[model samples]
Target: MVSRRAFLRGLFGSFLAALAMLIGLPLSYKWRKRMSPTRHSMPETRSGAIPLPYPRIRGEMSLEEAIAYRRSIRDYLDEPITLEELAQVLWAAQGVTETRYGFRAAPSAGATYPLEVYVVVAPRGVVLPSHDFLEPGSYRYVPQSHSLLIVRQGDLQEPLYRAALEQEWVLNAPVNIVIAAVYERTTRRYGERGIRYVHMEVGHVGQNIYLQATALGLATVAVGAFVDEEVQRIIGAGPHVHPLYIMPLAKPLEPYRVSKEELIGYIESHRKERR
Candidate 1:
């Protein structure tokens, strides 16, 4: 007879296997080349490794502290940052904490996990995963193992700037973190109505990054202005996945401030139950 712990472990493993099989492959790139104008564009794949250094880490913050501190910032200093700082930012945004369960720094719909993280880094501030500088390009971020896969090489600032509809914030920052999602990743499970889950997951990840930036003493601005097709192209994304938000990261220009009334109103609005 197996020990109780072993028996439970077996049961759980079997259950997950059965669940996966029953679900089938919910969403598998049917819209492979569906591009939209103005979306982020990128090359197909990277020929080399991306520079991802060991992340710099800090102790966890209390929920209150994280909330009280979180805010959106746009202005930054034209300063150089460390490879360690970049690592810490990515880890805080979506790095895997525990490999056993394949859990991520962000939540997903049904753990289908459709969100992809990418980065546009400058040379002065940080050295990346493999110390590979493909020269001003976008890269795919592998969070589970903390590595980057090159997608596109060469300066993409102009295209990204255009795709973002000439959002100066995208060009002003030292790095840009783009988050995209395969909508069907969640929708296929619960049907098209589940698209809400995809957006919800995006928001969760967005907030996670925001909190991390706050704690790290950095500035970040989330932008939603872009032609979806161009963005997908800038990142060299496949057809099914599409851009959702762009977060430009940099040093802070000034401290964040908010009035008590504004804070109260924000909380109250969020707290109200959906009709």
Candidate 2:
């Protein structure tokens, strides 16, 4: 007979498996390239790794300004994001800051650093200054080296967009950053409580990227609606790694504007509609 601890663990695992099957199967990619403006062809991986510039620690925009300017922007321009902009955003997300202590920009519980950052770069077929300096493919951000490790090269935006419920922004953005978490990193120390810590860490990472995007005048939105397994597959993440967030980065199509009265009116209108 199995011990009580083993029995509960098995039961919980079965519950999670059943929940995933119930939700994951129906939400599988049904819109694979079924929309307008076909995705760019797959990008070839570079044989050698490309080093990223040292992230600029100083910014013209103050932290308060960045926080105030932050917003969820979906529409993007056709221009490509330079490698420097990409590096800045990635660095803000999880780059090493305190080298001696091995700490990151975001605070990780016990410095377990469960989050893994993956960048999906697609520079081909885009009608902009060729950002061909870097290969078009999926790359994992190596925080220690401050460089990208090419996991898989090719235009992965198509599959990533599909996995993201066919969101246009996911496809249109020049780069998409996928964040995955390995719970075992945290759980070993805190047991079940470690799961909660991992999620909190992700939130910190997301806000950091959002603020950094604002400072750079770039656009990004946190995307949570996705099939976990599909996202894991798209980013070439293993089954043990859980995909937690997707942030597509690009230059905005137009300026951000809003009126106080217009906002209040919209909120009232939404209330009326709900009623």
Candidate 3:
């Protein structure tokens, strides 16, 4: 028969082992999660550049005012959005704010910014610094450089409109900001859970753009209902980058300040169009 002291010691040892596992397993997992790669394999430094340094200045509108002014605008005036406005909106979406940590306007899980921003410009001229620079085409937003890298050269409005299920707003808008993600960038850090994180990050980025647009006196609407593959193709994104959100932006034809009756009338018209 075992001694009483030995039996109690054995039980204590077993309890310690179980407790160790409960603590050690999570600690080990956290270590791995902390060190695992979170960045995309894309080059850290690129060649082509636009250098949007003008957006360094902050906007005048308060966050509360922007939230109140934000709307899902579909009708737009026949006007081209200035390059400065584009820069501001892009900066709001994902532009690098903290150079030290490469922190952007939107937060990412584990700082693994998996989202890639792309801009599609209308055929009309976009004036920058008193002169037109960008031709009508799809351009990738290089967050690191805070500039656009031209992906393809030519008008892409028709293809984008087709891909977006013939959304007239897409066709009419001077710029369409496409948010795409490379899941592997996040998944490498959090496995399947990272996909959800990427989705959450997109929402944050989209809201930033909406608020920025409102503050700038521009109008925009986030478009998610689209043929995914078609949008990817239109934007010339690689196979790894999955398109997530499309935001069509433009100058609103109607005044931002509308009476309650006018808002109701607009809603009724929208309902009729949906039928």
Considering every candidate listed, which one attains the maximal TM-score?
3
In the range 119-172, model 2's lDDT, one tens digit per residue, is 988864222224344557677787766776566656888899999999999999
Candidate 3 structure quality by residue, lDDT tens digits, 1-275: 33556445434644664484456545533553354344211222234345664574566877777886788999999888888889889999999887655678898776767899999988763656646545677877867667776666568998999999998999999899999998886787679999999999999999999999999999999999899999999998879989999999899987465456776898999999999
lDDT of each candidate versus the true structure: 0.68, 0.78, 0.78
Across 116-228, the per-residue lDDT of candidate 1 in tens digits comes to 88877654434334443224567667775576655665567668888999987677776788999877656755687678888888898888888787777777878888999
Q: What pairs collide in candidate 2? A: 42-155, 43-154, 43-155
Ranking by lDDT: 3, 2, 1
Candidate closer to the true structure by TM-score (higher is better), 2 or 3 = 3
Off by over 4 Å in 2: 1-48, 125-131, 257-275
TM-score of candidate 2 against the unseen true structure? 0.75
> Which runs in model 3 stand beyond 4 Å of their true positions?
1-46, 258-275
* CA deviation > 4 Å runs, candidate 1: 1-47, 55-57, 60-63, 123-134, 257-275
Ten contiguous residues with the weakest lDDT in model 3: 39-48
Which pairs clash in model 3? Answer: none
